[model samples]
Target: MRNPSLAPPINRGLILRDFPKAEDTPTVQDTNENDTNWVALMVRVRDQRDKTAFAALFTHFAPRIKGFLINSGADAPLAEECAQDVMTTLWHKAAQFDPARASVATWIFTIARNRRIDMLRRQRRPEPDDLTWGPAPEPDQADVLALQQETASLSVAMAALPAPQRDLIEKAYFKDLSQSEIAKITGLPLGTIKSRLRLALDRLRHAMK
Candidate 1:
């Protein structure tokens, strides 16, 4: 049977208080010694289910995770909930941690980032009952014509763009890719992605006007 003590702490307030303020949180860029220690702690949690190691990790990372979520636009309550979820996931998925690919802080922060994204997506999703099942309304002819004209103008503007800028814009809006994802796919630096997308958007805006 699983030991009850191995379960994550339920007292969140106490956990939050254990760490220093978010601004003081150590990042992935911290000293190599600290990073190496975190890796060892994670390995202990994975191989032995060591509660002491888990507690130490929790004490160090919980506040940092919470702060990261808040900075990513999650409110306090949501950030706290997501931080707890990230820690719980860490306990369960310790075996999945690949030290060769990423440091402990990077893995933990990635989980927190994904958790916040999932929560935001759930909040923005429309309830099934709120969806319109049948839509039979006919479009107004004038509105349809206006839309067609606007679409044609947009197409022309898009075609006029330099290939690189247009490609980035298409990936960003049409493919719904994050800047980081776009950078990886295009083999471009992240700053280049942002710069091209910004320039592309500015031209498109001016063209549409």
Candidate 2:
């Protein structure tokens, strides 16, 4: 459904040139920080409202998100505006970023993707007095029941995981923590966290079967 014609030329050099040099950005190797050290910047923004950290995030993600929006049908200017709005939302909602649930890139892109979709929908919305509306369809009871059953099954599977794995899964799915946040909370290496999560999910899939 995306309008690829609106996409701009994706030049990594152009995008990276606008951000701080790689040496200036925090890295896992330079410090004892985990692979998701970039998320620590987000946490700093959340706890201290650190403008420097926010600027770093904006510098890194804003251009990428603009490209994403443009690829999704927005004009280049509109994409730039939406990207700024997305960064503004990140600034205001920093406390809500959860590392256990998603990586920083995934979380930011999800926001961008959803915002772009919403903008598109609003642009296409009918006028209040437009008479083309009809009653909405009723909910499907059978489908609802099936979804409920799946939820129950998933709960049981989650309960069967090791406590640590269960805790991560709960934070990711229920509390909506990002992977970096989970790493911070659990003091686990990012690789270890990912491996454990993979193992846990494998068990969950088998349980579902």
Candidate 3:
């Protein structure tokens, strides 16, 4: 259940009265004093259960989170719901936030991305009644051979990638990590992560073709 006090307001101006616009707020890449301030707010929320601190955090982040989700292909209503859920989780998991490993924006946005993925998975999941409770049919030999060939080709392509690019690709696709998360783990700039991933994927595509 979500806390009523933390619920998103009907009017944006009502909640954002004193805070900066979403665009004006510091981003995950911004390593400024504001990041320290946000970390302090998180500490307040965690230790004091201070609604004022939580409200400040919410005002700064909620809209940005919603916009991120919408940009990622969620509709307005779904983005709103996911933003609310993310804020609520922030309140509950405030103690788990580690300032050393990630910025406040990074941690919060990672939660939003993960929540969006979970929602997508749930939407695509088949209902229990939709399952066919019977033995599966035998595979067509031609289809099996093609699948095996494709698998081998992919393995070869992956192995051929430069070590740096290949590591990022594996962390991204196989580990299901967001680019920001990958940047954190590898201690690389976000742009570097994206660039290497693009080059690696291009090479893999060319190889498979």
Candidate 3 segments exceeding 4 Å error: 1-31, 123-209
For candidate 2, the TM-score is 0.45
RMSD of each: 25.3, 20.7, 23.0
Tens digits of per-residue lDDT for model 2 on 1-209? Answer: 76876887554321212333334434413322322455667767877999998998888889988887776668998999999999999888776554433446656866776687678776532324511222112223343233233323333333444566656644553344877766544432233335544643454346446
lDDT tens per residue, model 1, 181-203:
66543432233224433543354
Clashing pairs in 1: none
Q: Estimate every model's Cα lDDT from 0 to 1.
A: 0.59, 0.56, 0.59
By summed lDDT, the worst window of 10 consecutive residues in model 1 runs over 130-139
Model 3 residue pairs with clashes: none
TM-score of each predicted structure versus truth: 0.47, 0.45, 0.47
The candidate with the higher lDDT, 1 or 2, is 1
Q: Which residue pairs overlap in candidate 2's backbone?
A: 98-177, 98-178, 99-177, 99-178, 99-179, 99-181, 100-177, 100-178, 100-179, 101-177
